[model samples]
Target: MKLMTKLSMTTLVASCGLASAAVADVKVGLIFSLSGPGAVLGEEMRNGVELAYEQLGGKLGGVDAELIYEDDQRKPDIGKQAAEKLVRSEKVDFVIGPSFSNVMMAVHRPVVRAKTILISPNPAPAPLAGEDCNPYYFAVPYQNDQPAEAAGTYMNDHGIKKVYLLAPNYQAGRDVMEGFKRTYKGEVLGEVYTSLEQTDFSAELTAMKAASPEAVFAFYPGGLGIQFVKQYDQSGAKLSTPLYTVYTLFNGAANEAVGDAGLGVYASTPWTYNLDNPANTQFVAAYQEKYGTLPSAFAAMAYDSLRLIDGSIAAAGSADDLKAVRNAMTSAPFQSVRGDFEFNTNNHPIESMYLGQVEKDENGQYVLSNQATIVEHMPDAYAGECKM
Candidate 1:
């Protein structure tokens, strides 16, 4: 009986040792607007994550990774449902995305309550930057208002005393305009809030033209951006009053669609394809080679999100420990493609925002060339309000 017991104990110890040495599966859930107005941005983000996954050899934190993608359809309720499913049923270890601000706001509560690490590649709403901030939430991208604030500073520096503001009538739009107004010393000729999916901006453009502002700053993103830029060009508004914008106007996806119409426009962004960095060069080349298109800021953020995750997990030495992972994320162990990157107390990025001008390259392709640093190591205005 003693000999049998000793053999059984040896067998159990060997099995346990093998199990400890084996790699575990790390599951990640991605929620984005895969089939709605924001679909283009969503696709770019997906490409970015997938590219990072490939570069990492399909592993995260030295473990096999299983990625699950869910379509939010650009709807808040849909995003919330997707988050619920990912957390409760799919049991993802980490969650990334919910492309737009509205969707992010809806899904934030549930994801936080579940104690899952939620990293946003886009959609840094003002509320989350402030009083509603969550310890579990981390934004790899710039805060929603940072680019607008940069544009405001650039316009102010350029002596643009009068401007017109236009954006969709949503929380994000309002926050961006507020950010612009924060630093802009000039007079706002008029403020126009349009519906989220409104394709026809003729009336708004006509009104904006009549206002005779020195410049126009619009924040129409995705298809809305393409429509607004084309209509603004056809409306001859570009000739009279130059257009300055934030994420909505100048990006790889929008520039490709807008073509020459986007030329000579000024905008603000946290990252651009023209940035002269090794990581950016590699990322741009790989993305273009993989997708047959230039990568946008959306893609850059997505790529950064995965890189950040990998770094965080490595720093923490475990993907399953939520507290350790959060600490590692706050430490920001990875080298961001966008120069220097850091997180504020609110877990939002404190990074530089650049002034970019859309110009035609030698190949006659519209590219956003960095003009200057609009804001350096800028932190969000709401960071003080966040207790955690």
Candidate 2:
């Protein structure tokens, strides 16, 4: 948590009594799991947002911006408290992320209840997309299930008839299974929901191997996915049944730790660091130069989220008007790292999903290779149920 920022505080012109020259200040609250297993993901998000702020010259919408961060500790109640503190106490105009779906669910209430904009950089659960959708809520990332659905569609196109499913026991895990099922018409040989904190996968691996599925699909994230991939590699499951996963290939620590073990594994995501556009190229280079490491999908999405915020505020002429801000956001007035981005009717993203295989780069390090768009302009299934 040391050396958190590289930008200086903004100076206001009002000190000289120049009212016309005074610009509004925007407060952004980041509530992510900065402790426990998900800490790596949280750090990635912070780094991305920080990089965005720095790139924006420490200002948003030509106004001074302040970022307040809080640790949810990977707990529901803790995340809820953080949300309350950000909105009711700190009066943040925008609140972003609790990282995991469970934590996102907990924080959704208070942020929306207080009429603050709840824009998630990641972990857009189904509840927020469907009947429970709120005007104050918006998600920059694709719905939790879109990547899994794209993976399932890819498996079906490849004639993979049977597969085993594994995910952490949580709302997102369930969404992965449901999304995969929605597309893949093949039989599911086995399904396992591992505990969020469980690192060892010996028992689960044993059962999965016994099932002899054509391929294995898993939706583990953060440290949990790192351990699962390592154990799955050690179990030699990839020797026979290939592994298809979401968020494991190009995410921060998970990708680096499971490097070689992840070779030949398949992944689906909305964006990749190696996209062939100038925005992505610039972002990747700047992020690597600043952090001395490749940015993850978490970072990329977070980077886009703040850029969206900046563009929205500018389009609104300032951060003082919520209705104008919301309108500008829905218009999506930003050049995203993804190159192409827009918000759906439900305020979730309508984005293309790509499939990729893990392969060694020219430097002999593992990278997501052979990426291609599998699902174009994919929208969440729950969007229809959203009243707003």
lDDT of each: 0.85, 0.83
What is the C-alpha RMSD, rounded to one decimal, of candidate 1?
Answer: 8.9
In the order shown, the candidates' Cα RMSDs to the true structure are 8.9, 3.8
Best by lDDT: 1
TM-score, cand. 2: 0.93
lDDT of 2 by residue, 106-197 (tens): 99999998989888888989888999998788898789888899999999899999999999889999988899999999999988898888
Off by over 4 Å in 1: 1-24
Q: Which ten residues in a row have the lowest lDDT in candidate 1?
A: 15-24
TM-score against truth, every candidate: 0.93, 0.93
Deviation from native of the Cα of residue 246 in model 1, angstroms: 0.8
- Candidate 1 residues 177-284, lDDT tens each? 998999899999999999998999999988898889999999887888898999999999888899988855576777889987888888898888888888899998
Q: How many angstroms is residue 165 displaced in model 2 relative to the true structure, after the best TM-score fit?
A: 0.6
- Candidate 2 has its poorest 10 consecutive residues by lDDT at 2-11
